[model samples]
Target: MIDLVCNVSNAVKAVDPKAKVYINIGGAVNLLYNDRLLGCIDGVLREELRSHPGPSGPEPQDPWETPAVLDTLAYSHSHGKTVLVGSRDRLKGARSLCVRAWSHGFIPVPQPAWTLGCSTPPRQFGAVAPQWLKATSKSIIRRPYTSIQYLSLFDIL
Candidate 1:
């Protein structure tokens, strides 16, 4: 998996040097510790900071304050990698988490209602939309060694 991600990233950069590759590895801190994988991608997207451990299991650790998570964020930032932390909750809860994320230097992605897409709730929550979300790009990102083109598909929720 690491090799695949690295190869894909290298292949993408071979064509469009400025294009970014962001991946969501489901908040795996161990994977974040992988320097090779870290070097390839532009950013990491953590779906939910407060993810459920599992049914009938212990609650999850606070990702924002967890030592390993903080270390991972620091490590990624040191390599010029963006770490986007997202949370799914009510408007107020989203705002709170967004603040927490920003305070820790991690970009916050608030999902009030995924069905509404990216634009509407940002305005409602008074949060600034990220650059990638604010505009469209003509540059198409393709998979490594394949013809599969992944367009800049933002605001699609």
Candidate 2:
């Protein structure tokens, strides 16, 4: 997964060499926290397991351990910095971060597909040609890759 992300970042950088990229180093969120008891309970239970006699060592830590990242982004946006985030989780912190960025006048680009497209592969290479290149070149130079390419002689009443 890291390799894939690096490859994508490199590809983007190759196209635009001066692009500044910020990568998120956090993982998925199995627990959540809010301002109320429900929020505290989940994280508290996980922390408790770390000190308990468990076979699995310890539970995973929450990703939003540092609110500084959010604060920095908010600050940068307030001072006119363009921040682009590719967030994968839907935690309360993630929502709060988005709200903070918006409040500070930053344009947050959420990666909805990153959270939703769990089963799909990031990239697939065909035996003949790559799908994106094929689709794009055909659409731009030749013709659109249409349903008619597969469906033929199907005109009915």
RMSD of each: 6.5, 18.6
Point out where model 1 deviates above 4 Å: 53-65, 112-133, 139-157
Query: How do the residues 2-39 of candidate 2 rate in per-residue lDDT, one tens digit apiece?
Result: 34434544654576564333333232211111122121
TM-score of 1: 0.68
User: Model 1 shows how many backbone clashes?
Assistant: 0
Instruction: Tell me the TM-score of each prediction against the true structure.
Output: 0.68, 0.27
Residue pairs with clashing backbones, model 1 = none
lDDT of 1 at 130: 62
Residue lDDT tens for model 1, 1-157:
8887787778768887877788776656678788888888888876556644456643566755466666777788778887776665545467676678767777766654453354423455566666664544455434321111132323112
CA shift of 157, model 1, Å: 20
- Per lDDT, the best of the predicted structures is 1
lDDT, each prediction: 0.63, 0.31
Candidate with maximal TM-score: 1
TM-score of 2: 0.27
